[model samples]
Target: MRSIISFLTMIMLSGCGDGVTLYPAKGTILLENGNPVTQGTIECESVDNPKKLNASASIQKDGSFELETMGNKGIVAGRHKVTLIGPAGNSDLPLNKQPKPQFNTKYRSYDTSDLTITISPNATNNLNLKVVPAK
Candidate 1:
């Protein structure tokens, strides 16, 4: 009985991922001044679907990033809203005690951010995102 239960669990776990297709995506983030944003996270949420399809990645020191979707190395091909988040001030501090983001807050929200991108199928999508700096 235990072995049968384990087999059933494995079958269920294997089917957890939906059948959404993903395309390879890579990109860089820079400020409007053309300087790379040193450290942050970037997320792209699908605007064409209501299924919460999204991809995200960490911005490297040189501002380069490769997006991943649910552990897959790409995003679903479609229009997506982009949002960026700066690194935390200090890891030792609590959330409230940490300093606010050094970049403009507008880039942190999908609704408020003007950034958008369209990912195409059968191609490696290379994106270049630029946003305003903090005042």
Candidate 2:
């Protein structure tokens, strides 16, 4: 009976399903203060539709980020947009006429700004972005 229960547990675990894990892309971004900007948000969208394949990640205090996709069960491997939004100050407030806030601006509470990127599928994408103060 113990052996049978063990076998059932194994089967159940194996049938959990496929899942995809995402890691930080290669590259670094330098901020105006000369500090390596590591904390930010990353959004992924489908290349064909430019609306599908939505994914996001928030940089940890240690300057690293990790995001997971639902897996390719329905999403096809291809090019996608990976937008990076960094924290910005109160200057990113929403406009009176704008119903929905824009990228990066939405993170104003945390002081983040938008930084869009393009990435291909089936492989890890390494990206670095440099942000300069608005002169």
lDDT of each: 0.84, 0.48
**TM of each candidate vs. truth:** 0.80, 0.42
* lDDT minimum window of 10 residues, candidate 1: 11-20
For residues 60-135, could you state the per-residue lDDT of candidate 2 as single tens digits?
5434454444422123345555555655335456655332222234323222434455554655666555555433
lDDT score for residue 126 of model 1: 89
lDDT of 1 at 67: 91
Q: What is the lDDT of residue 44 in candidate 1?
A: 91
The residue pairs in collision within model 1 are none
- Stretches of candidate 1 off by over 4 Å are 1-16, 91-102
Candidate 2 Cα lDDT to native? 0.48
- The parts of candidate 2 lying over 4 Å away from their true place are 1-27, 32-34, 38-40, 49-51, 71-78, 82-114, 121-123, 133-135
